[model samples]
Target: MDKNKRILSFLISFFMVISFIVPINAEKDEKNIFKEILKDDFEKNSSIQEIDSAEQKIYMVGVEGESILELLDQGYDEEKANKIALDIQNKAIESIKSFKNVKIGEKYLYTTNGFSITTDRNTAKKISLLPLISSISEAQVYEKRVNNVRNILEIASIKKEYGLDGAGMVVAVLDSGVDHTHKDMNIDSDNVKLTEEIVNGLKSKNKITYGKYFSSKIPFAYNYADDSSNVVRDTLKERADFSHGTHVAGIIGANTKDGGVTGIAPNAQILNMKIFSNNPKVPGASEDKIVKAIDDAVKLGADL
Candidate 1:
């Protein structure tokens, strides 16, 4: 085999072994193969920054500006601009996958420059060379900042006085599976047996519906699934995600007849549109999974 083919063979072999033994971590990126192979180029090439082992290996690739600008200059609306940008990003992602034998994690069209894709840093660098791509960098994962909401919304007072607790609303939580047993987070329903006298009296129906995106049959995920297959829910939070979705759901609509903690919208319903999981260690779900979940949520009549 030629030199490039030999390197490809080595990468394929190494990734195949790691894919089996090591669980993927969504927050961490793997070693950059191209950077290692093209160490000299990676250094001389101004496109990619020096490899920082401590940084998350994931990368965000931007779409070329000319396409979006053309759409804008042609008197296209904001919606059209957004659509064109997404199309460009998709093209970039498809080209990268075809050229590099790599998997793209997600695409972001909401970015000002166009869209973004997540891959190991080196694969991102390779993608940057594509004519359609603008730039590639680490995927920035932001933490949801929380400040006191009581002053802005007066949720406690609303619940107490106006009885404005979310009594008739459906909220779809696109996240990791909820614990379904947390005292403060889970709403008491038929599935669980609560010891509290108040909770036992009310025949509360289980509020959360569990759905997994990763374990299901999809070409992007590493999971090998066929017909008659479903992903098992990880209720223990043993995985890397650490119940972020659960916490978000709790804030939205956790209630207790069992004399436990109550969320602001205690009466609201939670739809567990689970997209992220620990099994594959993906940072996030693919574009298709998220789109499908949102479609499902809309069909299910999600108010939020």
Candidate 2:
């Protein structure tokens, strides 16, 4: 009886030790897993007290699921890819509710099973522990790198050599917005430029210019930021709204008819998919926006 009692006591103490040590080991393992996936840039930037003091910062989070491309690569059709995306969104929405004050801003299902979250570092650390979440990194702002335009003659030579006139191809432009009124970009016979009245009408949210002003050159346009189909650059608004897209479109397919830069493929029709908002807080295309744009491009039949 004495020996049996001692044996029972040892077993109880052993389990008690394990119960205490197991949690510590698990926590350490969790931190190690997070450390592996947290990008170096975000890790370095997070050390700054100023950023930490901010109310919230945006983060690009990866979740546990295959992307649309991956699904398609695995022999799933377009319909299945879309369904998978929806499932990922639903799961992410539910998972986000588990964390207090952590909000999902955008869902990226086509490129990755991930979304953007607006939360502080402390909450983000808690979120990282979630079984569904695969990785977390701070959102980064991208600046447009301007380089000297290559000689038009060289582009023409390449086009001539390759016989690539971009005929029947839809080139999607995901930038601030496109100035369809630009003479070089206008491919329609009417050559309709947005008059001040129409511009004012759009500003006032009038229905007059809702479906008009878009030409054959820019056949389709959508502003993802505002969930509107208005991709026309508002002249009355900030310069950023109009400048970048038009410049980019010019370099892509600007017809040299009216003394514009003759792009490499002057025959490609432009698909204006504006991702930037007029709001200064959103500097460039966040990861979610970029992935959304790519998904749109696939659905809309963009060649490039």
Clashing pairs in 1: 199-257
lDDT, model 1, position 272: 59
User: Residue-wise lDDT of candidate 2 within 110-207, one digit each (tens)?
Assistant: 65677778988767766776777777766654444444444546645656565554555566677777888777874423332233343345434412
lDDT of 2: 0.61
Stretches off by above 4 angstroms in model 1 are 1-56, 64-90, 107-123, 129-131, 141-154, 172-176, 180-248, 258-261, 273-276, 279-304
Q: Residue 297 in candidate 2 has what lDDT?
A: 58
Query: Where does candidate 2 stray beyond 4 Å?
Result: 1-54, 187-213, 225-230, 235-241, 256-261, 280-282
Worst 10 residues of 1 by lDDT: 215-224
- Clash count, predicted structure 1: 1
Cα RMSD, each candidate: 16.6, 20.0
